[model samples]
Target chain A: MNLLHYLRALRGIATRELLRFVHQRERFISALVRPLVWLFIFAAGFRSTLGLSPIPPYETYILYEEYITPGLIGMIQLFNGMQSSLSMVYDREMGNMRTLLISPLPRWFLLVAKLLAGTLVSILQAYAFLLVAWVYDVRTPLEGYLDLLPALLLSGLMLGALGLLLSSFIEQLENFAGVMNFVIFPMFFMSTALYPLWKLQESSDLLHTLAEYNPFSQAVELIRFALYGQFNIYACVYTLSSLILFLSAAVIGYNPSKGMMQKKGGKQ
Target chain B: MIQSIAPVLSVQNISLAYGEKLALDNVSFSVHSGECRILLGPNGAGKSSLFSLITRLYDTRQGSIDIAGLNLKRHSSKALGRLGVVFQQPTLDMDLSVERNLFYHADLHGLGRKQAKDRIQEELERQAMFERRHEKVRQLNGGHRRRVEIARALLHKPDLLLLDEPTVGLDMPSRKAIVEYVHQLTADHKIAVLWATHLVDEIFETDQLIVLHKGTIRFQGSVPQLLDTTATSSVASAFQHLTKEVR
Candidate 1:
């Protein structure tokens, strides 16, 4: 295909996603409310009990809200990614996906376009959350706002790829809610989103190990460092590798011949 | 009509299976330009499987399919570029205006902005939907939605159009309107159509017919020829006569 054609397809797909997001006012509100509730009510309850040791980014101990801000940003992306995948399943059932797949473009390119669109939406939601955090006085360094852009984008793509992979395997919409709860809860609770690794270790050795290995924790750390205008090499490596891995799996899962959907008796 | 013109769609001995169960067993057919061919089959006669294969939704494992002189397997982009499809299920984005939905399809086909707008306007006006172009698809009746889908499918001017049971849930009048529209397209635009459905009423006496049952073609000819072969007076009884052994 011509380069102009590919570019046009990308633009069309992205614009369609943005239009859908705009129409679903309730979805946007709920995406914000979930993280805002945690930032306000949950952080308020834990503020007194939680203590932080001086870390590289933090010269001194920080407030609970500041500490959890990156995690909640990560939360917004995580949920948005899963929500986009839920819509993919809905699209498949509703037949809109058939219209998309029948286009002359390569299937992988179409899927990546979808992934990029979802990531873009998640990033927009992350920025909205950041603005809300700023309004709540849980502000980062002013320069850190720009620095966090790349980190937030990478995290959104990684998490959205995970959602794409999950949607390809999920058979029905009713089954997706359970899968979302299983995935979102563990990935959030076990990560450093709400608690530091050392805190997890103090709670249990298994929890500490799980937190260390959790890709979500690495994503949060990447954002945490970027929000302070610093780089965490380990976090960057882990997040990039996970993004590649999940994205490849998603592409494979959407393949018409050997994909999970084909194997599961989709539209035969 | 030029007698030497190549068929718009040529399927050669395509066979498909899901594991050990055969879904389409060496099915083959061709539709020449300006012809409207009907693939008449019951719900489980593998009509959908054949469409899936032709559309490349499923792989062609045992045979080849050619669209407008391009092989589906080797030259998929060129082949698919010449094809249009309206699936059994409604594929419109309910939240978007009808015009926006058509624009998306146009962009996917790589039409430039000006060209896409012109084609979209022409197709919508032809389909009698230009007045309702700003309305969300959810607000339209089922028949109007199907018309919009057909308009979207034609935006790229594909030479071959495939409709997989397009009238499954429509009322009698709506069904008649769509069928008549497609018939008119072949006469006016010289576009080849493969219209798959089990409904006998949709088939005209002069149209070509392929009757598939249990993953094989029981008959392939005109409606009159099918009636003559079965010694039956109507398409319905001829279909029953042809499939009764398998049933």
Candidate 2:
């Protein structure tokens, strides 16, 4: 595609995603509520029962409420990314996907533009959560804001790529709900969202090792380190690698000539 | 099939299946420039599958489709660019303003801001939606939304247009208006039109008609040829007879 045409295509797909989010008020609010529910209610209930342990990035045991902020932020991006792809499946059923797939630009570019738009939305939601955290007096270094931007972007892209990968393979929209049961919850709970690796290591070594290797855990770690104005090389590497890997897999999964989606969705 | 100077669209022995269920069986037909081909079929008759193949929505298991001389598998996006499609479902964004929806489609076609604005204005006027341009799609009636879709489809000046059961649910007047307008466009613009519908009255005597049944083309000829004999006086009756005979 020519440069001018490419820009317009990107603009079109991006704007469509944004407009969809804006139009669906209940959906946007629900996305925010899921993270907030964990932060205010669930986190509060577990705050007292949880024994304080010195988490790595922390010099001393900190409040459970404060410790989980980064995890909540990661959770928001993860769920929103999946939601974006789920909507793509919905769009396909509704016939809107046909409009997009028929556009005279490379389908990969269009899909990437969609992922970028989802990341934008996730980042915006994360910022809103940050504002609430600040009000709760969960303080971080001033430099943390600057450091966290790139980390948040990387995490967003990583999660967005995963969502695209899922969208490419799932045959029907009904199967997406099953993904939440089988994939989403497991990934979120097995990661370092609620507790650090050291804490999990004491409870179960195998589980701790699994969490440490989970790419999502690395994403959460990257965000956690950046939130405290620290650099995390391991997290950075893992997140980048996952981003490339998921995107490549999604591209292969969506190859129109030989993709399974044609076999599944080609019928009337 | 009769030869033409240059066929705008062609399908060659295309067969599509959904696992054990076949959706299209060796369906082949060609429509030349300026002709209107109405694919008449009942529900589950594989008309929609043919539309999907022509638009390259899914790869055919057996056969090929070409649009404006470009093979679908080789040049899908380019082929789609030359074809405008309005599916049975309304694809416009309901929350955005009508004009905004048109602008988004213009961008999809890679039109510049100035050119898109000009073309949007022209298309809206053509569909008499210029006055309601600022209204949100959620507020518009069903017929108006369909008009917006048709207007959006025309933005790229396509070589061929496909309307898959475009007026599936609409008041009689609204359906008549769309039918008349599409017929006018086919003649005026000389763009080959493939209008898929089940209604017999929608098929004109001059328009080429094809009867699709169980994923295959049962009969393809003018309305009169298909309605030649046996109590099958109307196109719908003829279609029912052909499909029943196949069973």
True contacts kept of each: 0.66, 0.68
lDDT of 1 by residue, A13-95 (tens): 99999999999999999999999999999998999999878776788989999999999999999999999999999998878
lDDT of 1 at A183: 95
> Who wins the TM-score comparison?
1
lDDT of 1 at A76: 94
> Candidate 2, residues A139-250: lDDT per residue as tens digits?
6778887789999999999999999999888877999999899878988998998887778888999999889988889999999999888889999999999999998888
Q: TM-score of chain B only, all predictions?
A: 0.97, 0.95
What does candidate 1's lDDT look like per residue over B161-214, in tens digits?
999999999999999999999999999999999999999999877689999998
Angstrom error of the Cα, residue A67, model 2: value is: 2.1
Q: Given candidate 1, what's the lDDT at residue A87?
A: 95
- The TM-scores of all predictions, comma-separated, are 0.97, 0.94
Model 1 ranges off by over 4 Å: A266-268, B1-3
For model 2, what is the error of residue B130's alpha carbon versus the real structure, in angstroms, after optimal superposition? 1.4
